[model samples]
Target: MERHATSAELKARAKGQLLGKYGTIIPAILIVEIIMFAITSVITLPLDTQTMPGLIISFIIECLLQLFAGIFIAGQTYLYLNISCGGNIRVSDVFYGFTHHPDKAILIQLYQLLLMLASFVPLFLLLALWMVIDSLYMLIPITIAFCFGLVASVIISLMYSQSYFVMLDFPDFSAVQCLRFSRKIMKGSKARRFYLDVSFIPLYLLGFLTCCIGLLFVIPYMNTTYSNFYLELMSKRNGGNVQ
Candidate 1:
């Protein structure tokens, strides 16, 4: 009978791991943010979203950027997982995904994105039908469908939350296999994961109050906590062995 750590316990562990390392972690996370921001700014600086074609092009560019950003995300996962496991910290670790299997990293992100978009298809169809009908009577069904779609999207997101982490841990696993393994491990833990996520709301709110500067600290804390959560899950799944 393996015992799951409470969110408090996990956060405490993350705090312990981060105790003297904030100097390294904070700058590492900041460098990643700066690079991402610079990339987005440079790429979108030329786009004019005033026209229909421009809007469509802008949307496509945004989606492509997001897919590309998935590689950086995998790199972030690699960095944090390293921190959680007492490995050396490097700001350059942020490019781990790019140097590793970037194609598979992008594929994993693309699959998750497609699945999330699919979850919203029903709602989109209902909204289109409502627009065509323009009847107050159609509102009820549309609202119900919207709620269902929202729930499905949330669940799907949670189900695949660990996909990036899985990819980093099992370099040989296919993107689909990583997604499947993530869904498998998340079987009964979605609600727990949800609760852990919700618990961070206050810190985020407090961070926002500091003119957004506080997030420089909060973000790493949250990432490390999540890293700890992933390791905890893996440990339990592996009969008390983390790796």
Candidate 2:
């Protein structure tokens, strides 16, 4: 089996693509953050969050926000993909998901969310049992369940990390098909993906050291690199021919 590009190579490609583009990328990232902040602020303004009903409404709102965020993320992915490929892209392109097959985007996100929840079901069940039995022995099983759930959730997430990219590449495919294809291509490559992610920790830490202002730059660089990773993975799978 062939290996993908090293993390340094991918990041270098991302950096090269990002050169002179911060003028567009930074503002786009800010727009996304502002929009999310404004939506949360406006929606929760009238509600007394301390009350039970208000709390429930808040939870529902959070869930809806997550659903909407999925679409936004697809749009972001589209923008990054274009940037990485040197295609024409506008800051407004960040909203592409809303106009382009939003249903599929939402469905993909919902499916992933459900899978994550399902992964934790065992942990939930064991915790519930421990609550009822009130035995010290139950702690061992609960701990084991928690560990298993965490590992499963992480695996599932990594497996489907490329779903949005797949969706963009194959617009005709259904959400489930996109997910299945992502998992297929991701086989034996999750560690590569995970390592690539870990490699960004220093940049994230640097962003934090800058009072988060640097994250505006880091976010797009990281996203574009991940986009490159997806492209490289696809290129490898297709005999070095990236569509």
Candidate 3:
């Protein structure tokens, strides 16, 4: 494995790649997102979400949307990384996941969503118990339990953070297999990943400061930085033989 990129390097590389291309990348991303959202709504149409049938339908639709989202996310990630590494690129590169193994893209997302939900069981149980408890003082401990559950869920998430990209790298892998591989590769990078995530706070605030419009630029930069970090880590995992 080679030396991993510093946070600064990853972000700077993201910005550099997008320097003259924000117009294309941003609109392409937005188009993908809008289509995904519309399809999601269509799939779960006209259901009153307050009802049980509605809830179940919503859950199924949510899972399905995960599939669409995974494809777009992976596609965009490929585009950004390709351009950053000096490949000739096009906006339609955003559809690579779908044009390739769309099923795998969707399945990985469904699997990960289930895994994420499973991680929240403790939180759900605590909240349910908290709702039934009699005394006000008991609420304090319940609150603490909820907080603990939340922190645990976040840790669980970081463990699987790289799974989708791993799917891209190893298309033959089953969803569970990619998750296991992600956990293996991410062993010592959790804290560093956390720091990388934290370093985006100011950029997020700056976007917010611009009345949400600044997000047109900030979000794309954020996505590319994330892609760079993943590529850097992947390269290190492959002993500097990043393909």
TM-scores of all predicted structures: 0.93, 0.91, 0.84
Q: For model 2, where is the 10-residue window of minimal lDDT?
A: 1-10
Per-residue accuracy of model 1 over 1-243 as CA lDDT, tens digit each: 557999999999888888777777777778878888898889888888898788888878888888998998898899889889999888788888989999999998899888877877888798889889999998888888888878888898889999999998998999999999999999888998999999999999999999989998898889999999899889989988988
Give lDDT tens digits, candidate 2, residues 48-86: 988979988997888788888998999999999999989
Give me the overall lDDT of model 2.
Answer: 0.92
lDDT top scorer: 2
lDDT of 3: 0.77
Residue-level lDDT for 62 in candidate 1: 82
lDDT of each: 0.89, 0.92, 0.77
Q: Using TM-score, give the best candidate's number.
A: 1
Q: Which scores better on TM-score, 1 or 2?
A: 1
Full ranking by TM-score = 1, 2, 3
List model 3 lDDT by residue over 41-146, tens digit each: 6777787899978898888778767767888877876777676676777789899987877777777677767766776676667666767876678667667767
Candidate closer to the true structure by lDDT (higher is better), 1 or 3: 1
